[model samples]
Target: MRLLELTLPDAVENVALDEALLRQVEETDGQPVLRLWELESYAVIVGRANRIERNVNVEACRRDGVPIVRRFSGGGTVLLGPGALVFSLFLRVEKDRHLANIDAATAIVLDRVLTPLKGLVASLERKGTSDLASEGVKVSGNSQRWLRSTFLHHGTLLYDFDVSLIERYLSDPEREPDYRQGREHADFVRNLPISRDELRKSLTEAWDARLDPPELPFDLVRDLVRDRYRNDEWTFRM
Candidate 1:
């Protein structure tokens, strides 16, 4: 898989890039990609069809001047900011049963990701559906979007995030996986006690990902940011 080492200015462009790359691969039958990026500021990202009012504290977000954006994937709301490492995979789905089913996909991907972290951390495991946990606290949260021929799997790995921000902007998710067990965000999510470079190196090496420019159509990404991600109509549409 080719790696795209790029980070945009904000959540909107970054999120738009994920979908843009997915479209590029599907249209061109391009090689699978592994994109890694980090946020320099704070933002709250809701799932594609999630109700923002139910998942986010609007008043808090407004007061803090943090942008609340929505991505084109189905998952729980997430807090993104400094110390958060995002890894995205654009893969072609052939006869791989693991990629065909959501549960199987989550398991297979998490397992592969954990392989590199196993020696760095003790007792890393998958909790709930797509969460990677260590000693009962989540270190990573993942979600997916699929097309007829390819699927986009992306996730956030918390390396050293400010856990307090989660409670400040996000409400208790309306829907949660079984293992969550009603735990509050601050108590449930924890940073991976590892350095950013270590985490990135492990992930890139695990997938044998090579570094390269995406060569994607930037026009589509800009259009997506303007028309969908930046528009409150689409961001807030449940």
Candidate 2:
């Protein structure tokens, strides 16, 4: 797999790039990739099909001047900021049965990615569909988007994020994973007590990720940002 460690200017471009990479691979038969990135500031990212008003605290977000955007995958809303580590896997769908089913794909991906951290934390287990938890507190949340022959699995790892900001910007989700147990944001999430470098190293080693930079389709990303991600009509269509 190819490795691309690039961070864009803001949430719109960051979210648009994920989909652009997926399209690039699907259209050009490009190699699979693993991307790692971090945001420069705070933002709220909702699931692709989520109802923003129902899932986010709009008043709080507007008051704080944090942009509310949507991603190209199905998952719960999340807060992203400086200390959050974001990883995206773009893989081709092959004969592997595990890569075809949502449940199986999530399990396989999380199991492989969390293996290196197993001994570092007290208990690292796959919780719900795509969440990784340590001692019952969620440390990571993941979601995916599938094309005809490829898919994009992207998620966030909270290394040193401000947990309180979640409650400030996002409301109680209309839906949640079973393991969440109806707990509030503050009680439900916790940061992994690990450095980004260590986590990135382990993931790269696990997938034999190469250090090659991706020739990203910047034009597509910009078009997506202008027409979809940054447009309120598309973002809040619900």
Candidate 3:
């Protein structure tokens, strides 16, 4: 497994970049990779087939100057921006009848994330399909896509993000039905006690523990981020 530590200094075209990089990794040696990134500002990302109007408050986002975008994968729409740490793992695997299923893919991704988070916080448990919770609150959420021989698992870690802004820009209060309308941003969302550098270092160490030393994963993934993901068509396409 090769680990790719790619960071977006400012949120360029994250969704597009993710899709492009996933495609490239699948074409190459297709070693498993771990990618970490942060957005430039807050934006809403919906599934490819989702009805933007039905799932999100587009006018509210536009009025608030929030970008509403679509991603290559499917999941409920999510509010993303600063204070969120995004991680993606792209791997090549033979589709086994058992674990190749989406639920198992999520389990693998969550396990990889929780292995380092243990002892730091209470042990993480699955909130739903891809969410990991501490106590009754949600901390991390993930989603995946299995294509050809590769799978892309991506998700967010709320580490000190602006909860109030997320509440304001998301428009659809119904989006978080699990939490109910009474949920307060500060109460429902949280930041990790650790700093960005600390989290990144710890994540890399964790991946190293389980896989072969990450080789060309870094450069290959970074190149794709710069050239392909930064494009406009990839960001706003319906």
Candidate 4:
């Protein structure tokens, strides 16, 4: 697999690049890719179909000058800031047949990727469809999007994140796993007691990925940002 460890200066671009990589690979039938990135500032990423008014505190984010954007995948909304590590994996469904089914793919992929993290966070286990939890609180969350032959599995690893920010921006998710038990964000989520480097190492080791910077699809990423991610119509359409 190829490795890309970069954070685009713009949050929209970072989100766009995740889809760009998946598209680029599907177009070329290329190898799998592992991308690691972190945002230095706070941002709100809603699922493709999520309604901001229902899921996020739009006025609070606007007053604070934070960008509220939508990603190309379907999952719960998440608050991202400095201390969060984002890892995206692009895989060919033809090569990995496990990815052909959404539920099984999420479980198989997460279990494989999170094996090395057992040492980093004791008692870490997957709680719902795509959450990695420790003890009794949430630590990591994941979501997905797939194309004709390739799929994108990306998620966040909260190492030193401020869990309080979640409640400040996002409301309680409308679609909750039974395990959540109606607990609010602050009480339900917690950061992993680990460093970004440690998390990155564990993921890289799990994927057996090499740090090879392949030819990036910069034009596609820019186009996607301008056409989708940065467009307010696309963000609030739902």
lDDT by candidate, in order shown: 0.91, 0.90, 0.68, 0.90
lDDT of 1: 0.91
Candidate 4 displacement at residue 206 in angstroms: 0.3
**Native-vs-model 2 lDDT?**
0.90
TM-score, every prediction: 0.97, 0.97, 0.78, 0.98
Tens-digit per-residue lDDT, 20-83, candidate 1: 9999998888888999999999999999888999999999999999999999999999999999
Q: List the lowest-lDDT window of 10 residues for candidate 4.
A: 93-102
Tell me the deviation in Å of residue 22 in model 4.
0.7
The count of residue-pair clashes in candidate 1 stands at 0
Please give the range of 10 consecutive residues that has the lowest summed lDDT in model 1: 93-102
- lDDT, candidate 4, 1-238, per-residue tens: 8899999996899999998998999999888999999999999999998888889999899999889989999898999989999999998898877676889899988998779999777789999889988887888899999898888999999999988888889988879887889999988899888888899899999999899977899999989988988888899997
Predicted model with the maximum TM-score: 4
Q: What is candidate 3's CA lDDT for residue 163?
A: 70
Which has the higher TM-score value, candidate number 1 or candidate number 4? 4
Tens digit per residue, CA lDDT, model 3, 1-238: 4555555543435676677667776777555777777886788877665666566767788897777766778776778887788878776767334457788777776777788776477556677667877776777777787787888888888777777775565545334536433676556656666677766666777666344434444464466556544444654454
Q: Given candidate 4, what's the lDDT at residue 12?
A: 92
Report the lDDT tens digits of candidate 2 across residue range 53-139: 899999988898999998889998999998899999998888465687778788888988988878577598999878999888999
